[model samples]
Target: MLASPGAEGRADLKLIEEHVQRMRWHVTRSSFADVGQAPAIEQRTGFTEAFLYAAQGFAHGIVAIGRAAITTDNKAYADVLERLHQRGVFLSYLPGTGGPEPT
Candidate 1:
């Protein structure tokens, strides 16, 4: 995750999308939005670096969450997802509580 301010930020979404696409993981806005936006608080005091830092930190968390998902079972998935979202690491798709049925 590359964090850019102003002009730099303009390319962030596209760059992220391109990276995922190149890996053959199509990026949907839903997924990206789920990633959330870097907070604008940095702009308040010419401290834009804060936003980038937050973004980078969140990116690391997202990576860790993905790793957990790949290594754990379904029961653990919801736990990780919840933790990530609470920590502001990643976004989630919310629906009714019931999940997929056995195929």
Candidate 2:
């Protein structure tokens, strides 16, 4: 799981844990960004670690509050999608977490 630092981020992580549990998915690891860090993957150590862990075949997917939790940059998000696709991993979100609401 990935989230920004602070109480809200912690809560988001908890929600992700619950979601994963509900789905019966095992969580091999979790990661979070430092406080005040940009959402870009390159700017977030935790985010990069999560990807690396997945890339290394340690996990089957990445759980996050939402896409914005991963990145808002179009190019960055595309890169992430491609990487996940290449690795046969997935990215999921809690039912009602961050990111723009579904229209």
Candidate 3:
């Protein structure tokens, strides 16, 4: 998950963890990036690392509060979804977080 910065970001991380646990998924790794940074996935170190980790087959899914945690750019978000789909990795959003319902 990509957290913003500061206290709220920390809280978000904690919330994500709780949500993941409730869904019976284990968090083997995590990453954070400031939302203030460029929305491009390549420009965010933490987001990039998370993607790489997933690509390497270390994780089965990436969980976040919403799609915005990945990127605000529609193109970038679609690209991310495609890449994750290619890797057979899933992206999950916390319940009632305004993202698509978990499948």
Query: Which candidate's TM-score is highest?
Result: 3
TM-score of each: 0.28, 0.80, 0.83
lDDT of 3 by residue, 1-103 (tens): 6566678888888888888888888887666565565546767777777777878988887777777777777788788888888988788887887777562
* Model 1 pairs in collision: 34-91
* Candidate 1 residue 7 C-alpha distance from true site, Å: 2.5
- Per-residue lDDT, model 3, residue 14, is 88
- Tell me which of candidates 1 and 3 scores higher on TM-score: 3
* Model 2 ranges off by over 4 Å: 97-103
Full-model lDDT for every candidate: 0.34, 0.75, 0.75
User: Candidate 2: minimum summed lDDT over ten consecutive residues — where?
Assistant: 94-103
Per-model C-alpha RMSD? 13.2, 3.3, 2.0
Query: Model 3 off-target regions past 4 Å?
Result: none
Compose the digit string of candidate 2's lDDT tens values, residues 1-103. 7776788887877887888899888976556565675645777778788878887888887888887777788898888788888888788887765643221
Model 1 segments beyond 4 Å from truth?
A: 1-5, 30-82, 85-103
Pairs in steric clash, model 3: none
Model 3, backbone clash pairs (residues 3+ apart or across chains), number: 0
True-structure Cα RMSD, model 1: 13.2
Between candidates 1 and 2, the one scoring higher on lDDT is: 2
